[model samples]
Target: MSTLNPYCPDCGAAVAHPHAEGCGVARCLFTGGRRLSCGSRHRADLELDHACGGDEWTGRWPGEAEAAEFGWWTCWDGPGPEQGWDYQGQGWVQVPEGTPGAVPDLDRLSTDAQWDRHALRWVRRVNR
Candidate 1:
């Protein structure tokens, strides 16, 4: 058998076992949610309520349509360490920039080096 431990659903922080009963409310160290979950991969049924008394902040991903509507550059495809654009297999390759729905200039680069260089340039331009 496996033992279930409670953890913050938002940040994945561990929660005290004593506070795991009843409503199963656990404060998140990061997001500070009143409800949390266990740090178990098998346990996916968890709910988190923010103590700040407002709508939960649903984080947006890069290239999401919603992010684009808000004029937010959530989409980032570049050759950087923090941007997750580092070389994966075929060396640094250019990924589509801007939001997912937005059209990209397919004629930007021809080779891998060109793609990487252009992608990095584009990311820098948009980020600034």
Candidate 2:
């Protein structure tokens, strides 16, 4: 399932082929930065609407040596790929979108709650 975009920056030497599988990451855009900025950690430059252009880890080149050393793309393959990062309601002040009674309104984050201590993420409380 490895892929790559020849047009992407430094998308050469394989580096395990970065990008071209950038749909899921686009759907789970995260906005938990200091100023509620758009921050999606997708490996490709999908040019999403909510993308605040801060996904350097995926969109940029980590150099040929570093890319092979860490196998970066392998880090995001899972049932819940966006579980650990700032997606799927996972991150600082992020509320899991599927959580029962979970409302994610950046403008109305008046409360903060650790709904899932096991996951160790504090979601912003809206309308609670």
Candidate 3:
């Protein structure tokens, strides 16, 4: 079973040790929420990246126990098939930057919940 604890299952960083840069398991030290550190993408040009990326001494990822309390999940897009899935091109539109409620580009299986999240149409896989 995957979990966060004295050591992160993904990055293998101890509770006291700083999580590696861009570690997906890291949490947001700036916000008092259950959101992950990478809830938003990091870009060098964005002024907010410095503060959001933990440049101001925000400590390591939260431990398993604390994470469990908030029902926080390290990975939002669940597991996929062994062969994995690919992003589909249909039902997508190119929108201007900073558009509210913009659809995120997804690399997902047809059955992924993200497909339903945006009401995007998908077909069931057929066994060969």
Top candidate by lDDT: 3
Per-candidate TM-score against the hidden true structure: 0.18, 0.16, 0.30
Q: Which 10 consecutive positions of candidate 1 have the poorest summed lDDT?
A: 109-118
Model 2 over residues 1-128: C-alpha lDDT tens digits? 12333334422223233233332221122332321322444435534455332222243222322323222122222235445444454233323344433332322321332222233223534555
lDDT of 3 by residue, 17-119 (tens): 6656666665445432223534434544333543443421123333323323323233223233522456333344434434543332222231222112122
TM-score of 1: 0.18
Please report how far candidate 1 places residue 41 from its true position, in Å: 35
| Model 2: residue 25 alpha-carbon error in angstroms | 19
Clashing residue pairs in candidate 1 (N, C-alpha, C atoms within 3 angstroms): 7-37, 62-74, 63-75
lDDT of 1 by residue, 18-102 (tens): 2333233332332322333433233345333323222222221111222233333322345557546654434333333443533
The model with the greater TM-score, 2 or 3, is 3
Task: Return the top candidate by TM-score.
Answer: 3
Clashing pairs in 2: none
User: Model 3: runs farther than 4 Å from truth?
Assistant: 1-4, 32-50, 53-128
Alpha-carbon deviation at 9 in model 3, angstroms: 1.1
Question: Which regions of candidate 1 fall more than 4 Å away from where they truly are?
Answer: 1-51, 57-66, 80-128
